[model samples]
Target: MRPHRCWRPAAGGWLGRRLLRPPGALPEPFFLGLCLRCGQCAQACPRSAIRIARWEHGLSTGTPYIAARETACDLCGGQAPACAAVCPTQALHLEPGEPVRMGTAVIDATRCLAHMGDICRSCFNACPLRGRAIVLEGALRPVVDPALCTGCGLCEEHCLVEPAAIHVEPLNP
Candidate 1:
């Protein structure tokens, strides 16, 4: 039998697996085994950020995940995360007030307008958590605060640059 290949960003491989999982997702191994693939999570998402894993995902097929660049999780406004609330299996268990660390945003300095000495604050302004999750450094350069970031990907979705100057790197843990 072939061994499973978990996605790793540094390797620049597994491009398709770079998708971000919904908030409160279990670790990948457990999530793959426990998720019922009922697509309830996808249906519950107001932003339509969560999607069922496709056939190309191999063993992970039918699980819910997010592609932040396309659509980002909005945490469902004032309510609990909708996707997790609708999950039949406990695969997406999230306690109330629990923080989600979906992934971290990394800015590519070469492509970032603010980092290049431009005055772009799109990323900073678009962040739902604003000053807490993303802060402006020198020259209004947006810097992600990993400790507070929920990896909701709103910043990535709002980035004006082609190919996006800042992107979320999925956290497998």
Candidate 2:
């Protein structure tokens, strides 16, 4: 007989607003199915960006995720993304040369320093993809390009505001 699967709660409630999956992770359904829930991806993360969900997160418990506001994905710098590389089940599969899509960064102009008439280019300057993923508009306002952004959360990580002016909206969230 097959062993019983330990099912956690789904990504709902508070988790839905905060969960950010590791770079190159498969879509929600596919990832949940293929992931071994063995904590390998979290262990392989060099920046310690990946974390397993807790029991409070329900069905997503033990699932790997990221909280970009706290720490962001660095793309592993000069190597294949570690989380994907270590996922034995390919739940975090990454196609060669394809850009990862963690989510899209949304700017809250009401809270952004630049949009509020200050000279803050922190978000644009911090972007790994720079001019491509995030660009400077007139008056140094930062704009996120959905087509080019991987939603790696560098912008959110670098934002100086008490609450980040720019934050990623996870695909499943």
Candidate 3:
């Protein structure tokens, strides 16, 4: 069956992966339809993890997005996500204690220190789900379990590599 208009993947992702949205954001078209661009979500973020989309984002301009390399969502220390809490519309929604599956972190093994025979577990150590979302193999390489990953970007943020061996992909968008 043909995908519904609102349910189809956003065009941005057709060119490249979608930008990381704030935790609990609705699907792209639904979010764009409902979001008021009020900036409330960005303001509610304790870590200032949310940013207004720039003009370059085209249709997504003024929407709340997260740059994991700069800062990652902390889910307000496991409470309801602040961005979702402050959303006046259904653009975002997070129930208390719900894990934020914002995106999935993928590791570039070619660039990862551990995969190079060095010992680096920064991504594993920074994962909110600890051993569940990210794990270490016998060779000391960090592996991501997509099913369990919250995609909160902590691993990307904490990566010690210059370009970051791990990066979050907006899988849900």
Candidate 4:
């Protein structure tokens, strides 16, 4: 006999005006919501792309923040996000092969720790599309190569510091 696939609860999930909500007890979207925020999506992630946002973003407190650090649906291939599969939330709106507009990654050299005098290259290393997407503007700073950039937000996500020097913005909407 097959065992029952019981679901668990995720702590400190974030809610937004744009996001869809379901019902009671299970936070906002009941029935459909069943995530434990255990970070399975991050682990299964081939790119190590998923990220959970902190309190600093304001809009997203404990919720999963994908846009800021690593945008672009590289894993989806014009389909759905793998991370959502782990999410109990029908909250993540898991769809098959749905075309998604991923956010774009950007770098603010002036504010970047690398540019500010820190010998940090976290952003450069974090970018999956390295060499093509992001490149060294100088010994101290990095620049985003628009020509080679798929606009993946990895650089923004793994900045290794607060007020992320790299910022990922939504595509032209």
Top TM-score model: 2
Candidate 3 whole-model C-alpha lDDT, 0 to 1: 0.84
TM-score computed on alpha carbons, candidate 2: 0.89
Give each model a TM-score. 0.88, 0.89, 0.89, 0.47
lDDT of 1 at 30: 81
The candidates, ranked best first by lDDT, are: 3, 2, 1, 4
Candidate 2 residue-wise lDDT, 1-173, digit = tens: 64224432455324245468888878887877888899999999999988888766666778898888898988897478988988899988888987788899999999999989899999998899998889888748999889888888889999999799999988754
> Which residues of candidate 2, in runs, are more than 4 Å off?
1-9, 13-15
1 versus 2: better lDDT goes to: 2
Per-residue lDDT of model 1, residues 140-166, tens digit only: 888888988888888999999989999
Better of 2 and 3 by lDDT: 3
**Candidate closest to the true structure, highest lDDT:** 3
Sort order, TM-score high to low:
2, 3, 1, 4
lDDT of 1 at 123: 89
Tell me the deviation in Å of residue 41 in model 1: 0.4
Q: For model 2, what is the error of residue 13's alpha carbon versus the real structure, in angstroms, after optimal superposition?
A: 4.9
Cα deviation in Å at residue 25, candidate 1?
Answer: 0.1
* Candidate 4 accuracy as lDDT: 0.52
